[model samples]
Target: MTIIVAGVVVLVLGILAQVLGWGAEHHEAAGHAAAAHGAAHEEGSSVLIKRILVSLWHSNLFFLGVSTIGTVFMAINYVAYAGWSVMVKRISEALSAWVIPGGVIMLLVFFIGRHDIFHWTHDGIMDKLVNGKPNPHYDEIIAGKSGFLNLPFYVIRMVSYLVIWGAFSWKLRQLSLQEDLNGGTYWFHKSITASALFLVLYAVTSSMAAWDWVMSVDTHWFSTMFGWYVFASWWVSGIAAIALTAIFLKQAGYLKGLSSNHLHDLGKLMFGFSIFWTYVWFAQFMLIWYANLPEEAVYYNQRLGGFEGRYTGLFYFNIAINFVFPFLGLMTRDAKRQMIIMKIVAIAILCGHWSDFYLMLMPATLRGENGFLIEIGIAAIFLGAFLILFTRRLASASLVPVNHPFLDESIHHTT
Candidate 1:
């Protein structure tokens, strides 16, 4: 109830801030100011609103991705017959609920906020002629890629990815519940098979989804490593989320017998993936920077250069919070075993990765200093709602998989 109220309040406050901001801009535009100034202000407000909407949509998508990935992580454990995670598998499964509403909200944004978030959807942008030869609208490069970037196909791809992810998530949870009730190897066998299949599907779709949802925003830029980069970012965030959720439940006495060993395993994952994310980040940047190709370099240049080079600071800050902090903080074995330290690191990574996503999307979509308010407001809205759903689902099932074949092994698991 508190979470729901907070979600409503944050969402309303975010909308109000954008509306009021637009109203002020509109008022300034309508004043007896110079026509150029008025037009500039109007354009600024428009972009600001668009940026806020994109950030809101992206944050929601981030939640969805991490939640789904949390389940995917569980699936991998299922397929691998891993015993360490069984005690907390329910928490991972509970997070899957976010994918459903997240997908619906994303679809709504794609259709309604299409013009605001996607430049390719705007009038004459794709079709306009350049130099009396080809596409204009300062996006000839994007036009060249129009065969794959068209609206109809883009929409189809986005929907397909969501459907695939949502289906697998739903089916996995159903099978998990069924296993709990029946206590048979039949359900277990089916789950393993399904999990194996889901991993294959995820490998392809996760990359494609990253390209469709994020990379295409810049339109002219491309990155072969982007899919992995996104996966790494969200994957680590998922691990942190799982760790945090387990800690919360254990503290509440709901997840009795959840030991520090489980946390150490999760902490190890958080530590490893943070490095993986950093590697991807550097590999992507270094390759692009070293190659010095104008097209590819423009991507980083926009983030690093320009008068409003605040993104440069965020770029480093992203590394600091996501990689540096976690790397150093969780370096020692003792640190990973400490619940207090683990919780702090988990919370930091969550915030850090949120900033990572913010850096990825916002620098390309919106500009200026208003991002802090928008980030906090949008995060509050999504995080609050996410907690409400996740907790509700967690409550719907046993804290631990009571009938899991490896239940005893999991409970007695040691680092």
Candidate 2:
């Protein structure tokens, strides 16, 4: 209970601090832009406002669509695979719940800010052509792809993903609970079967989700590894989140039986996955860079050219923060055991997630301009909502699965 209170306080204060700080900085920067561009700035402001609105809308849509899918995955998995993961399953279920209300808010933000992000929302804009040719950026490719990308199909896919993910998430949770009551090997076997089924479904749906949400922004450039890239990011971040939250809960007198061994395992996974994420990121970039194909190169070109030094700097920094830090910090068994050290590494992992998502979204969303309050504001809103959901869900169940067959194994687990 106190843990929840503390989280709320921290969230409020942190958001307040960030909002005030970033808001002021953004205002000042906007003033400079206005001065430099003069009246043209006013004219551009109209366009900028429109663009921002679109961006906000698209962002909201993306979040809602993805969160629903994620939540569904958890729900169904809960029903289907209630055994093998009965112990560690709550971690993923909690995250699925986190996405629910947060997803709604994200959708609202997208609707409200529609003009800022998406080009397709413009009226009759896709029909226009340049020199008897439709502009690829404005209409041609995206428009052509609209058979699949149009609003209706888009919503349909979103719903389908949500249904699949939510079912999996819920069922997995349900079956785990059922096993506690029924005490049957049947449940265990069923769960294993379900997990296998869910994994295959997850692979396909997650890939499409990534393509629609992130990769489509570039439109022209496509990488086969993108889905895996996003999976690496989310999977690592999700594990890190579980670790951080688990640590917090344990500190607050929840999850009483959890031991340092669990923490050590979590730390090791975090370290390992961080490296995995780096590998995927590099593989994608290297292949594209080496090929130097116009389609592939354009994506990097936009980041390098549009963002100037910031994009490149951020690219390297992501590697260092997400990969190098973990590699060095969590390598020692002693370090993982030390609460203070674990806290710092945990915080780093969280920030790495933020940066990872930022890179995923921003280079494609903003292109050239420095990120501003709207992004921060939207993120805060999502974070607050997620925290609220996470804490509530955490409270609704036992900190650890008391009836899990592996409970003894996990408790006794040691090097």
Candidate 3:
């Protein structure tokens, strides 16, 4: 409750500052008055609301991505019939509980922020001419992609992804809990079948989601690997989250007898996927930087040196902190097995990825750029809420899945 109040105080005060135009005045002092207006050209009012929505959207999406991956982790384990995760399965389920609230927040922000966040929603942006008269604000690029990027279709896709993923999250949790009571293979087998279907749908929706939620912010730019790129970041972060939570629970005696062997596997998965995220990040950047296509290269150009070099520092920082720290910190076999090291590295990687999302959204959406205070406030709100839900869900469930067929295996598991 204290966390929630602090988060709320920060969130409300931060937004009140924006609503009062304090944000605009700050950017004006930096001589970005025109840039600030241009940033919200289609806003039809103050840019303040847009900035609030953008920050909220970023925070919600970050939490949502991590939450969604919890379900993804569970689904993958079920499909592969992997038993090693039985001990930490409840943690992942709790992490996934955020999807319901996250999705609702997403839908709310999208509507209230339509004109602010997505320029394509404006009346004439898609038209070369209105009534055969040249529309001064027409965007040829966005117009060309109108078929797939239209507001109606985009909203439909977003809603579909959330509903389907949320249902699976809730249903899967119920099935797992039922397994605790029934103590048979029936719920377990049902989970495998349900999981198999979710994976197939997730394979497509997750990518489509990346395109809709994150990539579309830069409506003019598209990448072939973006979906996988987003998924990789989500996957690695979810793994780190699971590992971190397991450690926390063990310390609290919620997960007693959790061995170094379990931590070792978690560490290995985190290390491997962190590398995977690096690979994806490098592959996208290197390919774009090398090919130097005016269209494609512009994406990096703006991020690397554009926007008055506001994002320049973060661009390089994004790669280094995300790739370097994880690689060196978690490289040793012993490092992955140590509780203290695992906790530190997981916290660092989670923070690194938060910055990763900042890089992804801030440059495109909040070009005027407010200082970090508001961002911190906004993040605190979502982070606080997510923790409340996650902890409650975790407490509601049995720490160990006693009825799980692989329970004995997880207990005696070795690295």
Best by lDDT: 3
Give TM per candidate: 0.90, 0.78, 0.94
Worst lDDT window (10 residues) for model 1?
36-45
CA lDDT of each prediction against the hidden true structure: 0.81, 0.62, 0.84
Model 1 deviation from the true structure expressed as Cα RMSD, one decimal place: 4.1
Backbone-clash count (model 2): 39
Better of 1 and 2 by lDDT: 1
What ranking of all candidate models by TM-score puts the best one first? 3, 1, 2
Which candidate model has the greater TM-score, 1 or 3?
3
Model 3, span 365-386: residue lDDT tens: 7664544556777788788889
Better of 2 and 3 by lDDT: 3
Q: How big is the positional error of residue 167 in model 3, measured in Å on the Cα after superposition?
A: 1.2
Top TM-score prediction, candidate number: 3
lDDT of 1 by residue, 1-415 (tens): 5655665676666667666674445434223322332232123236456756787778887898898887799899999999889988998899898998999999988887776566567666666665687653445676688899898888888888889889999999999999999997888889999999999999999999888888887777899999999999889999999999898878887778799899889999999999999999999999999999998997887678432465788877888998889999999999999889999999999899888878777655654433465567677778888888888998898887888898999889998
lDDT of 2 by residue, 17-55 (tens): 544554445445444543443231122234345334434
